[model samples]
Target: MAAGAGQAPVVTNGIHTAGQPVELSIGLPHNLGTRIHLHLTILATSIIVFLSSATLDGAQAGAAMSSFIYAIPDRYNPSQPLTTSLYTQPSSQDFSARLAKVLVRRTGKLCYVGGSMNLANAVGGGTVDEEMEAFRAIVAVVAAEVTKARNAEE
Candidate 1:
C-alpha cells in the first residue's frame, strides 16, 4: 500500500514466544531503505539485550530469543518479501554464549552495517542520521517488550 505523504513507516509489534523465537515485521516507506538498516540495527541490539537479561538456560535462551526480521514488500507488493533469519548456535557451542555473539556480529553485518548493500538499496532510502535516530527509538521499544516478556515468564 502506498504511504500517505509525510507518513512514517509502519512497524508491527514484535511477537515473542516462550519456547520459540521472536519475529518482527516492519513496513518500509517508499524510498527509505535506510529505515530498514535502522530496523535491523535495532533488532540486533534488542536481541543482545534479550539474551543477556533472560534467565533461561543458555542454549534454551538462544533458541527462544532467536529473531526473524521481515520487511514489507515495496509498494506493498507481496511477490517480493525481504526477510533475514537470525539463528542461535546449537547446544554444543559453549553454552550458546558463543552463538549469541556470533548472531550479534552476523546480524550487525547483514542488517545494521553495510553487509547487504544491494538488499538495503532495494528496500528504501533515507539519511544515516535519520536512520540512527529511528534505530534508537526502535531499540527502546524492543528492549521494553523483551523485559515484559521475561517478566511474564517468571
Candidate 2:
C-alpha cells in the first residue's frame, strides 16, 4: 500500500522459509541523506533485526556494525522494558536500543534481538533530520510486520 500523507515511504522484501514468513527486509527512500535498510528474522520467541545503511546503488551493505542491543519485556510492567547493549565501537548509535524497546513494548514479545550499524555516508554522518527520518521509517515498517505476524497467528 502507498504511504499516507506525511509518511515516509518504505519498501519491503519478504523471504519465506518452508512456506513460513521467517524473514523480512526493507529499505527506506533512496533520496535520503543516509539510506537505511532493515532485515527482520521472526522467531517463535523473539524477533531479530539487522539495521544497516545502504550503498550508493541501494545495496544492503557498507555500514560497519557499531553495537548489538537486546530488550526484554518487564514482567511487572511490559511498557517499561529492560535494554542493554554491547558496543563494538565507541561511537555506537542508540537507535537500535530505541527500536528494541519500542518493539518489545508494542508487540509484548518476551525478547527482541536488534543491532545497528553506523549509518554510513560517503561524505560523513547523516544530519539529525535525516537520521530521524530513518528512525521513523524503521518504526513504521516494524509495526506493519507485527500486525502481519499477529494475523498469521489467528
Candidate 3:
C-alpha cells in the first residue's frame, strides 16, 4: 500500500528502518531445464550459476515483484545445454519471492534471485523450521518442473 506513497518504516523488535528499491538477480552455470532435472530425483549433478536475491509474493500471497533470470553454459561444453538462472523480484516486499511462483508457472522453470528478507517481521514468530520448509517447497517445485521436462522429452 506504500507504493508511490511515503516509504513506511518496517519495524521489528523495537527496530525501525526504511528500505529503498534495489535490483535483484541470480545466475546459474546450467540451464533451467537441467537444474530442474537434477533437482527432480535429487540426482548428483553440478550446475553453476550466480543467483540473485529478490522478493515477490505470489498471487496466493499478497505482494508481487519483477525480476530477471539468466544462464551461461560452462565455457567448456556449448553443445550440452544452456546454463540458466532466475531472478525472483526486486522489491522490499516480503512476498516478492512467492510472486516468483507466478513467473515459474509462466516460464515453467526454476529461477534464482538474491535479496535480503525483512528480518523485522521474520524475527517474530519465524523459525528456522519455517524457512527450511519454504526452501523444501521451492525444491519440490523445481523437481516437479524437471519431471515435466522429462515427460516432455519422452
Which residues of candidate 2, in runs, are more than 4 Å off? Answer: 6-8, 15-30, 57-62, 86-88, 111-116, 120-124
Residue-by-residue lDDT tens digits, candidate 1, 1-154: 1235654444444455553444333333333433322222233223422322111122212223333232222336433433333442332223233323333333332221111111222222234544434444344444444455556667
User: TM-score per candidate, in order?
Assistant: 0.32, 0.74, 0.29
lDDT tens per residue, model 3, 17-51: 11111111211111111111111121122111122
> Distance (Å) between predicted and true CA of 84, model 1?
21
**CA lDDT of every candidate:** 0.34, 0.62, 0.30
Tell me model 1's lDDT, rounded to 2 decimals.
0.34
Indicate whether candidate 2 or candidate 3 has the larger lDDT. 2
Candidate 2 lDDT for residue 102: 82
Q: Which prediction has more favorable lDDT, 1 or 2?
A: 2
Q: Rank the candidates by TM-score, best first.
A: 2, 1, 3
Candidate 2 residue lDDT tens string, 1-154? 3577665455666643422443333344543344555667666667777766654655445445566777898999766999877554446536667777888887777444444545555234566666666666776777677667767766
Report the candidate with higher TM-score, 1 versus 3.
1
